[model samples]
Target chain A: VSLNLAFEEAPLRGSISFISQSGTLGNYLMLLARAKGYSFRAFVSSGNQAVLEATDFLEYFGQDEGTKAIILYLEGLQDASRFAKVVRNIVPQKPILIYKAGRFDVGVRAALSHTASIAGNDRIFDSFCQQVGLIRCYDPLHTFDMAVALTTQPLPKGKRVAIISGGGGYCVTMAEAACAWGLEVPTLDYATAQKIKEILHPFAPFPLNPVDAASDVRPMTYARVIDILMGLDYIDGVFMMIPFMFEFQLRSAAAIRELVDATEIICGLPAKYGKPILGNMIPRVSVGPALDLFQKAGIPFFATQDESARAMSGLVRYAQIISLAKEVPFSAEKPRFPRADQPIAYVSRVDPVNIPERD
Target chain B: VSLNLAFEEAPLRGSISFISQSGTLGNYLMLLARAKGYSFRAFVSSGNQAVLEATDFLEYFGQDEGTKAIILYLEGLQDASRFAKVVRNIVPQKPILIYKAGRFDVGVRAALSHTASIAGNDRIFDSFCQQVGLIRCYDPLHTFDMAVALTTQPLPKGKRVAIISGGGGYCVTMAEAACAWGLEVPTLDYATAQKIKEILHPFAPFPLNPVDAASDVRPMTYARVIDILMGLDYIDGVFMMIPFMFEFQLRSAAAIRELVDATEIICGLPAKYGKPILGNMIPRVSVGPALDLFQKAGIPFFATQDESARAMSGLVRYAQIISLAKEVPFSAEKPRFPRADQPIAYVSRVDPVNIPERD
Candidate 1:
């Protein structure tokens, strides 16, 4: 929904609410959400904060029934203490994911000049976020990625991730990426390996943590293997990598249909088994339909294994934050700092500025 | 130009030659180049490297009259010493930008399975690249970004950069990004500051390294400020951030035309003054024509300030590498690593392997 008007075929409904200080960023995010099939409970572009500040919106969303997670793009703040109080109050009930720009001195100066608001000390803000259990994101795309994973998939219980792939190479790449992203890829148990071996052709590699199904496995066998991996008590999550180009050349229609079916089945297992499942498809034009299917199924699909692993790591981190928040109770007290009411000045462009060109 | 046949209105011509190990990556790159209006001298997909490898193509492009930079996507190598010799030989004459995947164990295994070639010790390869003065990139898009900057713009003499923006916020963000990427945004001298202030309105912030022109400054004034910045002997390059949204809202048709004309002028100054000029336009649907204009003028336009800075950094790094390569002479004798020829094995998909599904 835009500031001027709201266009809708139906009422928007989801667990995430996005608030942006920049209208352009808000618009871009809205377009991205529409393209990626992500829904939101509400979207607000707090242009200049003329009437109300981000703190007020946070207070409202604290009691909001629809929003389970909050995503914010804040350039600067008018009242740091009030903002901190609001974050402390709301973070217990919902996850607050923030992308605070102007981390450096130049960025801070730019923020002040752009909005006439002071961006407080970045180090203090970082500490405040850590204390308040806020998830800080560096980029907009990553913010969306983490938000989607948090809202859709169940929070991962641990960092152990099982890598599954139709090709050995993808499995290897994902295993490395998973480890680099702080997720462990432990070797499967001997019994589990024996069971997997019984189901695969002798030419196929032995079933390990990154269980490679040797490129031409039947879809049913693929689904069974994934189910077995997910059911294992030791495995916390699954990272499935699909080699689209190889599969496309083999059986484009049948392979895609089977993969779609398998993904639907796998997605259902996430909720029933309490383990998050993430999919990474080798980016190709032919995989568009398959990607659409995964999106329709409410599965988080990434273009690269590194991105997928990073998202999974975020899920794990958020889960840990929520659990830690449960252990530590935040104090309920108003900040003592005086709140200043600054007049909002809109940038006028009617009288065009003419600067004499120097020789 | 594709593998099947050329479907061209005219012969493609540019100073960059791209070689990919995967056809999918090559095709995707071709699409990106077409969309971004980047012409290429040559594009080769060394599929399986059955007879000829990436080194052979690099050797050929090294002597080609049309090529000035080489971009490679290498999965693995059959003869490491031979590849190193080729890179050392070519890099002195042309910049060789390589994106070598399979840095980790999983990635190495994947590389081997994908193309039946053993990925050698990554650390040794890294040292070899450093010794040969090769520019290494992490991703394909980055490789392309670096190649465009290296071939299209003159090498930067130093790391000092001057950022100019119609919007204060973008300049600030770019300044921070520039510093983070190791490019120094030194404060403008008193003379330079006075000159910029004369070209800007009194209400605008005082001219600094990140000179912010008030949003409504005429496009001609914007061009003049950029030209002045480029002409400064202290500045090595210029990062110009255009506030397209602000201009679009003011007078879209005339503003875009003027902006387009200003960009054309700014692009010409880089060649005339021997300083690199990069641009970042606030990405919006309405700014398509403006972006297209930049692309048509052969100016590298990026989506974000960080990306623009990173590309500039890559260019600077390449320049440094070329200069250093001239100081060190590569040995004439080849190393004693044995050359092995392995038959390419195509992934067969005819016999659908049936594995018993375990309940």
Candidate 2:
């Protein structure tokens, strides 16, 4: 099937291209990309990748002028060295994001069942991604969200992050995952703690990083909390955790709207200044209406804590890659395409008209 | 979108009725049912199931002339007692199979995220289902498969099970799951073991009931193992865990076809001789084309070990329900409907003709 993308921009227009192996998955990605309206340069489905190897695409993506980053859904690889070399070249110019399937035992079996794919050493690849400055993502949704963060936000000067939650449990979950992801939970200054304490009750302790402003918090409380968190010199990013627990009553909706609006405004303030805001919208089931408001105001929202960490890390990685791109020189000689004489197997087997019919 | 289903006869023809909550899941079930050519009395969808409760539909299905069994997807309950009472009444006359969502913690959250359904006390419902003879199934695919088994094959006389595998690992996995599911693994008699030795190498000690004939087995070896296992007086069912590892080669399709054909012939022969077979398709991902062959021969195929146990248990539960149906007397009670005068919001909210188009 023909692949649909958010942007028809040329490959060289910037740096990121996402390649998916499954047509159904590719279509789903396209739908989400359009919904998110991420300015991705290109989206392609390398079905089978029998002729146009993963290395060839990586090489082409590395040199593309418009390409800034690259994302991939790997089924299996043909040449590991070529893949490594291309990543080595691209990491100096642009960041590459990857979500490699068959990472888990169940996933490997699932892949094997689907296409008899040989699931190679996934752990080795994860380490390899880190070595090459490639930002690894967990799922398709997280991939797009990370792209937004990476493209928009600056590299955090430090790992110190502030977490604000609408509920106590969500903030706790976010703090735990963030800690696991290597983000620092630094203590806030006494002045900032006192500011938070003025709004919060005496029973609830005003924690340094993860500030749980209880469920009965109003819109102004959210704004004040954001101000206090952002004011901390050690905090590089803010993670806002909101749940979908409230009903769709008018008063509740109004309060939610105010909270979301204040959060968005604070996020913009951080953008206006030099900090980053990573909004972790936990209890991601019915929080859609509330999230739409924040999203419209240019705050990238994440469903899970792990995804939020991925997005934040991606943003930092991309900023580093952009800086690296400014220093690295292009190759004097263009890399030759291996198997150039080989017939395009993907084309010969594909009927563009018939492909869409499957969708 | 219109719902599609295949029915051998109308609702008045005395057959089963299956219903679902989600349209997408419902459509998949319909596809599977149609593919198998199931003669369902009727199929219905209670979209959102807000006003007209599951109990209301169950009562309607109970008194309906053609319905012999009822299948459902229980995401949320409107009236648990009413639903339980309907099933309790139908237990002695008509069988009911339920696949309830929200049993697990994550499942409950996922259900709410997907359909805005508040998953209530799942433990209470689980005990209630067992009390009322409602057959509970785990995997959706297995649920549909068990429906076929219950309708086609006679109930197993006992839980004594024999496993035939191409490898030791898969055999062990099957043995563990079957034994855990209350099926006995009977030791093969010396004569039966010798019969198997004639087909394969005699030196390799048979792995007891599993009869792992090793990797160098031919189609004849598999058939011989099945023959020996089925010949045992204590073995009530057969679990075939075939891994299509050798089927990677282009010419291997023929070999797979031969093995599948042989397995089918042996399995059908057991029923012919008044014994039932519960075939557990091991390591779901490797089944490939063999699934189609097994289904065509009325052999149950499961993708996972848990699912395999679930399907067998469902069939056993259905047998108990069938026996109970024969023992208890059912009165021709008058069917009841929800009070029509009750105010129902959102019923006419979206007028199909003039509703705003969604992107």
Candidate 3:
């Protein structure tokens, strides 16, 4: 239906999948997701859903190994009870993010005209999503922001996140948000602080909870800090800032080699320590070739402190969601809408190459 | 002291000014700001605050014709009371946005090492900002997110905002945010809505608070919808989404003219109506030449729904701040510190070509 949409993008396979009511809105989400270095496993535009609705597709992808995270650009659920039933079973093993439109009376009216979907009482819908263990996103971009961490990184075991920074400003910014998001920013132990001080420049700030290197930053400072933080028993993840643009002037062969070496260590830590590492810049920049190195190494850089911290919290909260799900018995059910004899569109087999394996 | 910083930037004169304790951090902010189509009026790296401190620069730019919005990347106050006195006078006339660091004990310890300034209580700083009518930013990029609207757009009279969208999903996303931020998303009256409906694509959704044009959107549709929304009796501002990419495939000169004409109407709204018009995308992107036309016309587009709402709320809140200031008696204070004998670095007169005068 949206073949006439502006972009005709070649599929770049990854672990995220989206099911949207409006095909145009789905295309907008896809464009931005690709900009953030995420690629969809499949996208289903559930037009009118006269036969196969959103949840039917949701149930199919719920067990699909390729779809680690599912995003819904939703107006209204086709079968509310059926959705709640299916999601309760799937969320135990997978993540489902919903960007529910028509939350207010004004938007509800808009949704009615755009599609013939009934946007029920919003507060009821919200609590229902919570009850079913589905993550509700406030905006379209927000769906991508929270979904990225779940798809790419290893889940943090607990709420203890170590924040490391090249600039002290980011430490304050990320710490404020991390605290607000119910994640702990614990102080570094004396032994770990001493170890970091030995590697830092003489004029640099002393290591603390944020692990502020300040003026001591280099291309490799990030790798060293991550190594020490990830080694700590109490830390569950590292949500940190990198100043790759600080080393952006070094176009020489040796400088380029130094950056690649540092990226290898930084990217390797999440799998090494069984924790997530969310990288960011203080002022939230997306330009520079230096960023490409980390992205290529599979370390997706979040643009803002709020985003990176919120992404980290998404991982921590999902840990609880998954843990809670283990107690509930899974109800296996047959699809209500009979499948078409034709195969589903564009959904392929699982590609393990995209997902990072935890040791 | 830090002339070795990577890129040498040519001065792109504009209304925003920044004063930071850390030079590196300020540069990162500038890089991202430029990427968002902003240029600096003056940047002062307050190194160690030996003779001229951050407040000294603040007091200077507070009076400078060029600096419409003042951004402070602060660690700690060298002289808190005098700083308070100076800012209270300046903030009523021009916004002084502060992104304060050293909030918690962890960040405080880092700040002590990074700069030789005494860190204070976090709650006190936040409350003090609220009491004195100064806006306290949570993050560094947040400073620009709030500051851009102040420098570029007119102050909204009230909290009422009309959201217009090419995509129904954005109507939901933006309306959700605007309401959360305390801005009213009031439905359009029968007459006004009918007028909007008359111009909309016949199959499109009815215009309400969000004014969902949906599939009815066209290059000229934005100009017509914005024209009605801006001219409304109740609307204080319009925060809308544009999909120039919908018409992106039309490579002919005719399609380009259509987009360019819409840009002129959208950008000219604030000055025309004495209210602000903030443009955005559904998934929050920053690409396309269609944007270049809007940027050249002095309209700044915020990237996220949260950011656009927050920016709108910043303007509404500042209007209250200005009103509060007007009620209080003005006590003029003299600068406690002496001025530099030589001229201040790069502080020049503002070019009025940048700001859109509110009639």
Candidate 4:
């Protein structure tokens, strides 16, 4: 079933473990996912699953201590109920992302002949996925994007996102996207705002939720503001919109040194305080030492505000799922799809009883 | 207002003309948009607009024959009604994109001090944009993505999109995005399906709405299949999902030659048949000769399925806006918001009478 199966290792050893249903398709997906600045510890193409089903691979990856996250590129499943049971047991430990192909009529036909299965043809399967707390990925390639944020950064206590960018444009778009994606962009407190304002340029506006520093704001100032936001009790996540066109701006060694220092300072903030900090470069840039150093230090930077906002929202959703799972423990022995209104329409709510005040 | 504004030219002269309210921020945006495989014809930093307001610059770029598309980065407008009138006139000639920043309380505070206008604060502004046929951009960077598709590709006669990809997973994800964005992925006609099925590999399945040609589809077969789809009366736009890990595969000169030939063949199909052909590289690839050649041919390629799908939808929405504008001519004399249910929630629909049967 795996025709001409090939796999490429990521830049460095990372936590994600990928399992694909098709050999050629899955391996190609890995090559694409790696481009998003994520590395994989292992890749398994369980084509046809003749010897062992997809569930077995899921269970294996779930137990693997090295794998912090598991990503699946599935066409169809032979026994979905078993897969759900296995996924339920692993939700508390790690986040599992599934990109199921052949959902539509034509795609179903392709999957039928290609993989000889119809598990993905039904709508109930998706609700089952939600019930079992399996993250469903719309864009197959973006599956890794959420994984990068989920694995590297600490889970936020709530779905509250803060934006800090030198460009007012980036701040506006990032805040709008965050709000659109079910994440709160609450206004900063007076004391916290004043603390951040002092670090910004004198002409910069009061540190609102986005904390829009002036265009001339330095790298160290950006990092300091991020540190302040991450330390706040109300802020669950921070999206740092860094300056773009660094390749042109980095004219001398001094500029490069400052960038490296800023990267070093910003990268450690995610782990310093227990809230996730996602970097969003003002514009969509492909390469820069700033990005390289940050990614190496385990801080993922997105090219666009939409992506950065969506990734943070996914992280928040993952936390909510985990919290929900805890409230209603899974019955692995029996797998049943609740009525459409029951688990299918699950909304992300800030449950203080379910989520701890802080990690 | 633009402190230390420095601009970098794109690799080549593209059709987009960018106008930024802040010189420094605007120039940086142009540099970033260029990385997405789009070049710019002009970049204007309309700082403060002490004499010439943003609307005046918009009027200038609209008249410039070299400009095929106009992208605006405006935090506030001194004259919203005047801007709306200018945009209405430009919409029929060329697609206009606006990335209006300073939406929320904090962003508004920044905008208030930075430029001194409150046009963006009201919800009526967005409705005005819709009525005026101005394409509102979400992600400042992705505005270029939609612009690339709009400027280079022909206006589709309908909102029917056909996805042809080497991978089944790409087809599924792309189809889902297309549908979500208010485009149709109709089943192919019997005769056309048979013709496409014959061009695919022997094992390749029947060409459905998304002709999921099996793995190992050659460049020539892909090009030929695209040509057939573009020629069909039913298909409006085409999403070509190219193979990934090409850097590894291009070890042989023969492989490179095939890609070059394929690129040449596929690039001509869009313009020849008067339809948009967008490329969705399987994964998120930053660099590739295939992408370079396609983009150079005026066929823009996106890095991910999400971008590819949304961009095509944007293109269709632009066409729909133009169609709607024609049906209900704009009254520049009276500038007022329509009823909340009027132009506020404009959904894309396939109106046969409004849309020409074929161009």
What's the lDDT of the predicted structure labeled candidate 2? Answer: 0.56
Q: Mark the regions of model 1 whose C-alpha exceeds 4 Å error after superposition.
A: A1-15, A24-41, A47-51, A166-176, A190-221, A243-260, A282-292, A331-359, B1-15, B21-50, B112-121, B243-260, B282-289, B329-359
lDDT string for model 4 (B254-317, tens) is: 8778877887888888779988988865434444577667756877777666577667877876
Could you give the C-alpha RMSD of every candidate to the true structure, in order shown? Answer: 10.6, 18.0, 11.7, 8.5
Off by over 4 Å in 3: A1-7, A217-222, A243-261, A281-293, A328-359, B1-7, B102-105, B243-263, B282-293, B331-359
What digit string (tens of lDDT, one per residue) describes model 4 on residues A1-359?
Answer: 12122354433467888888876667657766655445777777787678877788789889888888888887788886677778888988999888776545555655665566675644676667656777775557657878888888888888777888777656666676665455778888998888888898888877777777878546788878888888888889899767733665486788778777877888888778888988765434544687667767777777666677667866886887766666664676543223233321112110100111111
Give chain A TM for each model in order: 0.80, 0.67, 0.83, 0.83
Q: After superposition, how far is residue B197 of candidate 1 from its true place, in Å?
A: 3.4
Q: After superposition, how far is residue B141 of candidate 1 from its true place, in Å?
A: 3.9
Model 1 misses residue A333 by how many Å? 11
Question: What is the RMSD of candidate 4?
Answer: 8.5
lDDT for each candidate structure: 0.66, 0.56, 0.71, 0.69
Q: What's the CA error at residue A101 for candidate 1, in Å?
A: 3.3
Clashing pairs in 3: none
Residues A1-359 of candidate 2: C-alpha lDDT, one tens digit per residue: 22233234222222357776654345445554543345556777675566676567778777777666678766666777677777877776666777666444434443443334565766665545544556665444556667667655656766678877654435444554555454666766788878787887565555555676655346566667777677677888888754432344225557666756665666565666577777653222333344555655566665455557657766655655445445544442422111122122112101100101000
Error of 4 at B243 (Å): 5.7
In TM-score terms, candidate 2 sits at: 0.43
Q: Candidate 4: which stretches are off by over 4 Å?
A: A1-5, A8-12, A102-110, A119-123, A216-220, A242-268, A282-296, A333-359, B1-11, B22-28, B102-110, B119-122, B242-265, B282-296, B328-330, B333-359
Query: Across residues B46-75, which tens digit of lDDT does each residue of candidate 2 receive?
Result: 646766766777888888766656788766
Interface Cα RMSD, each model: 19.1, 24.6, 21.5, 15.7
Name the candidate, 2 or 4, with the larger DockQ value: 4
State in Å the error of residue B342, model 1. Answer: 38
Over the stretch B1-359, how does candidate 3's per-residue lDDT look in tens digits? 11222236643677888888877667767776776666777777785678889888889888888789989988889898889888987987899888877555655665665676666887667656765767766567767877888888899888899988777767776787776566778889999989989988887777777887866537788798888889987999998777774445256787777777777777788898999988776334444566777777667676667678878877887776776577656654532222223221111111100111112
Model 2 segments more than 4 A misplaced:
A1-16, A24-42, A55-68, A79-89, A101-127, A137-145, A201-203, A242-264, A282-290, A316-359, B1-359
Tell me each candidate's TM-score: 0.80, 0.43, 0.84, 0.84
